[model samples]
Target chain A: MSSGKHYAKGSPKPVLPDDGQLRLFSMRFCPYAHRAHLVLKAKKVPHHTVYINLSEKPEWLVDVSPLLKVPALQLSAEKGQPSLIESLIIAEYLDEKYPQNPLLPKDPLKKAQEKILLERFSGVSSAFYKIFLQSSGLDDFSLALDIFEQELAKRGTPFFGGDKPGYVDYMIWPWLERLPLVEFALKDYKFDAKRFAKIAKLIELLKADDVVKSFYVTPEQHIEFWKSRRAGNANYDLLA
Target chain B: MSSGKHYAKGSPKPVLPDDGQLRLFSMRFCPYAHRAHLVLKAKKVPHHTVYINLSEKPEWLVDVSPLLKVPALQLSAEKGQPSLIESLIIAEYLDEKYPQNPLLPKDPLKKAQEKILLERFSGVSSAFYKIFLQSSGLDDFSLALDIFEQELAKRGTPFFGGDKPGYVDYMIWPWLERLPLVEFALKDYKFDAKRFAKIAKLIELLKADDVVKSFYVTPEQHIEFWKSRRAGNANYDLLA
Candidate 1:
């Protein structure tokens, strides 16, 4: 479950070895890819990662990823390393394949609830893209954030899944982890921390992973990454 | 397990029974809702359905579906008939609850493959919306359809999950069912049957369900419903 070592973006993808190891294809700052990293970390699944340059994608990625997106899990099977794309499906795949520390609840209904939460959180990502790309629609996102806060109040659970941070938490946290960067870019824009107490607390717990040694990027770096992408020339080597 | 009865569109919703019974909230012509109807049929789940007037959404639906969309499943339990919304989530809930005749493949990797297939098919829906709404861009949709056909060919499976139709087949079948309707709206547009032979076969299997007595509406009816909606006065009672 150790944080996957960073493979320099634009580096050639390593050969699909017969060693039978689960490999993840991702970019350092992509939240969708981060979802896979969080699930792998939470489940303590031993795996490796190959960072892809979105601007200059490797041809090999398409062989595995039908859509050529990251967070594609290349399973180490005797038959061959078949790749699985889409973070939600990959997360579910990890949960099902490695049953030792389950990310989803044991109860079917509760598990369904976790998935619904993931669906509900889609608005936040949409808001993020709209704000970052078009530089509009911040207020619309706040409505979704408010609903999320209300849901937390209604549940009265420390995390979405009672005491533990289940799939929903990990699924949502990847984006929330980068919200600070959004705030930095969009001045005078911030979450009402007091109103979103649970979220604020969750962010705090998520902050420990921001240390330089940690697997994921820090909020400060994310802001720079956004600035680079906005210029139409993404600086993938900012942290290199 | 039995097929759910369809409610007349535009009719008032039936009283929610206190007795436990799975009820589906849907619109007869809605392809998204049709996804759930197909799953319920495949699983043979004995559920009731309330056809909603999407144009005139009921207040009660908002209580269950935050987005006020249909394909919401209300599960009768001792506590209450808790409702689940969104076609995919509700479909998963149904699959999880009714273990018999599983919609998804049993193997984790196979299950992941099915989900990725569903995700890949999403472009078809988006392309459908773009072409239908903007009244242009048929070629792009054909490319997506081409990928889908190629996928079925590559796998050499009767269905996306192999053999009998499963979740992927049901989830995607709804949109493909409407492609012909789109073709009706836009001339010189048709799925290449020879290219998509597997899909042509699936359509043959799907047509029997298109009989007047089936719970869902036929593709011909879908074209009429779409025409009605386009004119800004939907004829929900077209089938009636």
Candidate 2:
């Protein structure tokens, strides 16, 4: 995992030789990057992490990620070697390449079902984004949570991926991890754990999972990060 | 391919027995659904097409597709059987299930690269949507096209998938197919073919490809559909 401060614009470019080791360009507080982190930890993929200052992006990032986004997985450290971007795509690629502790289902239909669940989870994410930006959308977030609760009951599984925290569980984890911080931001926000018993249980289960625990951040820390972001001078190196 | 009008609200529910034959719930004029059509045609996948009215969706669509979106591939005709939604997911599912005439690459890295290209194509799609709605965004569309032109030149492949049109080609074709209609909608928009010579040639190649030819719509026909859509009555049955 990445340690130390984020490399911002004008920071000396780190040496990235073709060492055959995987490198992940990431940001500590980014949920999307967090998704990749969980996948790598779960799979035990050998990779190094490089933090980037998103606000003042470095010039060299475009070589690896044309879109200049985080969670870009560099397969080789060689300059001009293209890196994979998009959290889902990066996770899928890692799973495919590593082929151990598989994140996705092998059966095509079953895999599609898992992906569909993730698609529905987008509603929750949209609501989360709304709340993050404007401190609203709790109603919509609750409605989205209802869908998850129903799906969990129908599946009758411990995790969304069945018995273990797999792709869907991990993909959705980053957002769930920050819910407390979101609740802190909102006035009189109380998550009805009883209504969403299954999801609530799943959240607790994920919190205890080995992979999640290693990369997990506390609600207090998240709130601190949120404060920094809201203050217009995001402290990307809070834990560095 | 479907041969009749779309099923709208108040329409009788079609019998969906537990037949093994694949069914694609699609709309005639939808670009996203058009993507699935091209893939099915290219792969020679034996599938039935059922057109749905977007404005007045049938009640039964919810059973097959929870999201009620087009290009929902029903693996079985049985009621309550879930169908796949989202064009890219459906396409990926089809490719994985069939495993013949593969739309994606075998190498995981290569596949990621192709997928990344598609990610970049989102710029063009966003611009296209702008023009479709307000008859603007030609400049942005051209700028997005420049990226495609560069990528095509860098790859030096006849198509994005090399030698033959594949997933990315088919996925992007729907937008390209409607570009002419977009041009017609604008006052004095002329596509600079020379600037995007490679993409221009690619458009021609895709136009002539057997699968694409089978599902081709002329610029004039697209203009008619656009006119209907702009008038608040989409002519989904134009070809029917």
Q: Chain A only: TM-score of every candidate?
A: 0.89, 0.95
DockQ computed for model 2 against the true two-chain complex using alpha carbons: 0.84
Candidate 1 docks with a DockQ of: 0.78
lDDT of each: 0.75, 0.87
lDDT over C-alpha atoms for residue A138 of model 1: 87
Q: Scoring each candidate complex against the real one, what DockQ results?
A: 0.78, 0.84
Which residue pairs of candidate 2 clash? none
Candidate 1 stretches greater than 4 Å from native? A1-11, A15-17, A208-213, B1-13, B209-213
lDDT of 1 by residue, A81-149 (tens): 688888889999889988976879867777777787778788888988888887787887787778778
Write down the lDDT that model 2 would get.
0.87
Model 1, position A228, has a per-residue lDDT of 93
Chain B alone, TM-score of each model?
Answer: 0.88, 0.95
Task: For residues B1-240, write the lDDT of model 2, one tens digit per residue.
Answer: 456589999888776544577899998888999999999988898878889999999988888787788889988744455688888989998899888899999788888888988988888988888887887888898888898899889989999888998888898999888878767867688778899899999999988899999888999999898889889998889998
**Which candidate tops TM-score?**
2
